[model samples]
Target: MLLLRQRGSLSASQLADELEVSTRTILRDIEALSAAGVPVYVNRGRNGGFSLLPGFRAELMGLNQEEALALLTAGSIGGRQVFGLGSALSSAMRKVVDAIPAGHQAAATDAAQRILFEPQADLLSRYRLAEGISETVMNEVRRSVLDGRKLRIHYAAEGRDAAWRHVDPIGLVTVRERSYLLALVDGHDRTYRLSRVLAAEALAAPAERPSEVNLAQLWEARSARFRAGEVQFIVAARLDPARREELAETALAIVHETAESDGWLRMELTFQDLRHAAWAIWKLGVDAEALSPPELRDVLHQHAVEIAARYSPRGPTLATDA
Candidate 1:
């Protein structure tokens, strides 16, 4: 139903591939939809597919109060603002709320208020948000993905100057507040950070991409392959119970972890190198202890000594520009 509404029409094979089901299953589902009074129509030909009749729309009447409340509360988190869908989400939510029966509407609204999600920073650590992307560039990239057009992007990759590249935009993905454009360059998979896109242009050429894409599966496979190629420097440590979640968010990866009897967290972690490990542990201040790899402990100790010396009253006065 959603695919028909969004794309106007799609073949059984296309629907099966997108949904990860067999063509037989898709045909059965189509029959089921029609039997359930959904206005599904099929066109039989080499270049034909199924579509919904004009003026036919799936309604919110099927949603019960509890289900509606869950969606309403989830929307209240406001994460859609980062994806440029805030206004659209607001409008959709209004329609959802208005569709509830008058007797249950007040109860559902109250239930939604009982659930709260705060996206604020932690008190003990400095939180840094992801870099912002240009709205114009994002819009252009989005257009290429939705319209199945090739894109020409001026991108600045890590340690490289901005350069023009042509790619077929597959999809857009947001992970841990950072947005990435999953694309194909020279018929190979590539990922680009949205923040690094200095400019983007949609091309008239149609994108040569798969008829169907499982974005989450694609992202997971690419991410696994990326991690496998990186250098791994493992460290064993003890971390504060209160800062466990913070450490997980900040570190490259927590390879292994367990809660100790004493309430602290004991863990094995992987980092890029010695310097990376030292910097991460140092950020936690006294809350984290490097338990092994004598060199890591030595590095942290030396850094602490240097910091103490720089702050000593007898040491050189803090520099000031006059």
Candidate 2:
């Protein structure tokens, strides 16, 4: 019946044929819908078999109040980060709940009493401009990817002046709660974080879709290699057993822990740079040492020398030495 109403209206014979039921069955179904306050009407002869009264819409049949609230809460959260959707989403949800048949209202209210949503602290304080820009760029990128269009973007890179370039928008990705646009630039595809993009505009000419190269697979391989580059040296450490657990949680390096006698721990990890690794080890205060990668050990040694030089007694005055 809902499907028939969605199509505007249907004759009883047509409804029966579509539903694979007898005409009498269709009549009974329509009667049941009317009883449930569906506002169904039947017209005889040359015109209509049945039709929903003008402006009538199907109401929620089985959802309880709690379920309705849960759906609304989720929609609200999504609306906060999405561009221009908050109030409409809230209004639409209310309309849906209000349209529920009278019989189900009590059940919905009961369910609502049992359900709750606690908003996160940062949910209401999200950066609106950034969110709006991200949403716009993402929507445009998706459209471009689907239509095989080229995009001209003003991109900003760390330590370099911002520049504009034309690219074939191939994909969009979300990583660590941030969005990025993946594009084919100068014969290679690379990801540009949307936050770093100063501006983006679509081009008039569409680019040809590449021949069967999987964008997602290429992205994963490239991203992994990029992360791996952050580790420049492998530094081995001997840690006190009690302190070993604390050191293991560090993300600046990858740590390998080994059992050692006398309550000591032997571990090895990769560090991006000697100075950074040295400072981190120093912060551990006493239980850690840079055992391998002589360059990193030298860095620690140099730091110690510098600290000692600062505190050492000044050379005897010339007159005193004489």
Candidate 2: residue 242 Cα off by (Å): 7.8
For model 1, how big is the CA root-mean-square deviation? Answer: 14.0
Q: For model 1, what is the error of residue 207's alpha carbon versus the real structure, in angstroms, after optimal superposition?
A: 1.4
Which ranges in model 1 have alpha carbons more than 4 Å from their true place? 1-62, 122-130, 232-249, 254-268, 273-275, 286-302, 313-322
C-alpha local distance difference test of each model: 0.85, 0.68
Error of 2 at 264 (Å): 5.5
Q: What is the TM-score of each candidate against the true structure?
A: 0.67, 0.49
Tens digits of per-residue lDDT, candidate 2, 24-78, equal 9988888888888888876767876687777665544556555666765565442
Task: Estimate candidate 2's alpha-carbon lDDT, on a 0 to 1 scale.
Answer: 0.68
What is candidate 2's CA lDDT for residue 85? 41
Residue 260, model 2: lDDT of 80
Writing each residue's lDDT as its tens digit, candidate 1 over 47-145 gives 899999975666756568988898899878736666566666766776667667657878888888888765545666656475688878988998999
In candidate 2, where is summed lDDT lowest over 10 consecutive residues?
Answer: 78-87
